[model samples]
Target: MTTFADLNLHERLTRALGELEITTPTPVQASAIPEALAGHDLRVVARTGSGKTAAFMLPMLHQLLQHSRPRTDTRALILLPTRELAQQTLKQVEALGRYTFIKAELVTGGEDFKVQAAKMRKNPEILIGTPGRLIEHLEAGNLRLQDLEMLVLDESDRMLDMGFSDDVLRLAAECRAERQTLLFSATSGGNAMEKMVASTLREPKSLMLDSVRDLNESVVQQVITADDVKHKERLVQWLLANETYDKAVVFTNTREQADRMGGVLVASNLKVFVLHGEKDQKDRKLAMDRLKAGAVKVLVATDVAARGIHVDGLDLVINFDMPRSGDEYVHRIGRTGRVGGAGTAISLIAAHEWNLMAGIQRYLRQNFEYRLIEALKGNFLGPKNLKSNGKAAGSKKKKMKKKEDAKKGKKPARKKPVAKKNSRTNKPAVPDTNSGFATVKKRKNPGSID
Candidate 1:
């Protein structure tokens, strides 16, 4: 029965929320807002679309309003892993601060650096950007955080995955030592993540709103086995034709795959847009805009480009290629089933990729239902053998090696390379007379061209 009123949000922010019809706080918002508003550093582990964005923003905005200073540098900073996320978060910030004089600006990559620098020079009250781009600005003396009051690392786990951990740590160190830090991630565990949290947050109040297993409870997760990439494409075509959906996002692992799948889907006469790291900023924005407007029914994207995509009426997510990790799987499917809406996530798994899927299932500690298409029943049914614990059986060769090594009471030494036997006799073979050396000796004797 708690509401935004109970959170003691700034009057202007409360009015803004009321105008937007955001009266009640989500579980995450309710749990973290009070602590965050109290100036305590926090680490929030919540599912995507669980209102994590507002949970951090509302409190940060509330705190920023108290001191209300117009300066040349940012008082608060929010670092996301991708440019798209930064842009999206900026939109939310603008909407929430509509009534307040607080100004927030984005400084992500893919846009003109000089232009962003120009904006930064104006000294907005808040700055949101990806780590690498922010570092670029920092090195160029365009952005500074020495007097920053608050720092929020949205999608912190993704930053590590994208290899921006060092840059993030550096940014945090450059910020004011007394600033409040908030780190939010869909994942909360991992050595690297743990190290970053320990260094960045000082005794943070950790909030675990949902576990990985329950992240997609609202989405029906299913698997469609495919023979290969081509087979998967056909299955995609079939699903789009037969399944019910408002909009669909097809996820691939690489930019090339995203482009290729987009091409395939386009050739089939389906309105599709391609999005990935290699795409130009304008094109990326265009693709998203088209998809959001329902001008395009499908969006093929790599994980990098899809981070910031949250389209209303998007009820289906298809994994063209199984993600490499459990965390990735959670994120890919998370594109749907957002904000308590019902959706479906389908993954295309080939025969060779069965073990990879099994590992993800074991990692998430949840099993996916196997669904078959009557017309396109692929050769891959499922993993042939499974262990007693329901996991895919280990490799036979690996199991044998382990058993043998255990019996020997020591590990076996690596086998040395065997020397190859010479097929020819030990004596050198006679040289060919036509090898251009037949008359070379006579000519060379006199050192003349005879």
Candidate 2:
């Protein structure tokens, strides 16, 4: 029953939380705040919407408040995988530091470099940015980290996935050797991730709040089989019309699909907004604003917006197209069932995508309930075949077996024989290794053998 008040946070931070109506500490904050405040590096594995941002932000802010020093350089640096996430984190930092003298700023892509560099010149106590843009500033001599006391790598897994490992590691190496490093990731284990953690964090305190399965328990996940793209569009329209929801987001794998779904939903008289990487920052920000303002009930987006976008009162998440990975599925659904909220995640699964869906379910150690609306049932019932363990059947194993059999049945390739010249010189000449010619050395007799 420990609250944010009991965490010994800065008085200003407590007041800010009170104004924000955030009284209770999330499990991650409860577990990690004390150690973080104690000046220990931490590696936290928790799901999205778990208040992990507050966990690290509060402790770092508290440390900054307790040890006030002239702002010579950035004292705390937080690196996020995406620009949106960095901006969101910067907002959190600014809000919590409102009553204090602490200065927080953001540096992300899609902005003028000179403007960002000018902001850097202000020597903010806390600097939050994406890796690529931050690297640009570092190379441009606009930012320095020699005075940095804390380094945070938020969404480490996503950063690695986006090929930012080299930049992140390089930044970490450039910082003060004794600086505290905190790595927050959703995935708990992987070889590459292990290496990153070992290189970045010291003997850090580890906090793993919940695995993917445990995180999904609070959300109701279901699948609706679609006959094809058309059928999926119909299902999406039907669900939006029939389902009860405060706000909903439909996830697509590609920007094209996101746009198409947005059009379809709009055509059906539903308020919609589209968000993805291709959209300009202005458009992306406006989309989020519209969604949050309740001006739009449906937000169609790609996976690029999955982790960064957080919406309050979002009770339904529709996977217009199924996610490719279990972690992505978890994150997409996580946008809704936040902080003990009751949420629903419905996936539109085409016939060809059943195997992919099955793999995700198997990875998460859970099965999605198959629900069909009676009036709009599609031709695809389900996967016609299933594995022994009841997962959707796939032809991959059979294809591999067939390939092996074909290779075994075929004859081995023939090896060419090495030719030798007849001593009598009757056969076509073959050159000797040492001698340039046949080395026949026209014998004393034309036909004489050597």
Candidate 2 to truth, TM: 0.87
Q: Per-residue lDDT for 362-437 in model 2, tens only?
A: 8888878889899898789887788966657667887787788788896445698976766676767665686665
What lDDT score goes with residue 59 in model 2?
Answer: 90
Q: In order, what lDDT does every prediction score? A: 0.88, 0.87
Candidate 1 accuracy as TM-score: 0.86
Candidate 2: what lDDT? 0.87
Candidate 1 lowest-lDDT run of ten: 439-448
lDDT per residue (tens digit) for residues 278-386 in model 1: 8888898898889888999899999885568788889999999999988889888888888888999999999777888888888888888889999999787876788
TM-score of each: 0.86, 0.87
lDDT (C-alpha) at residue 395 in model 2: 78
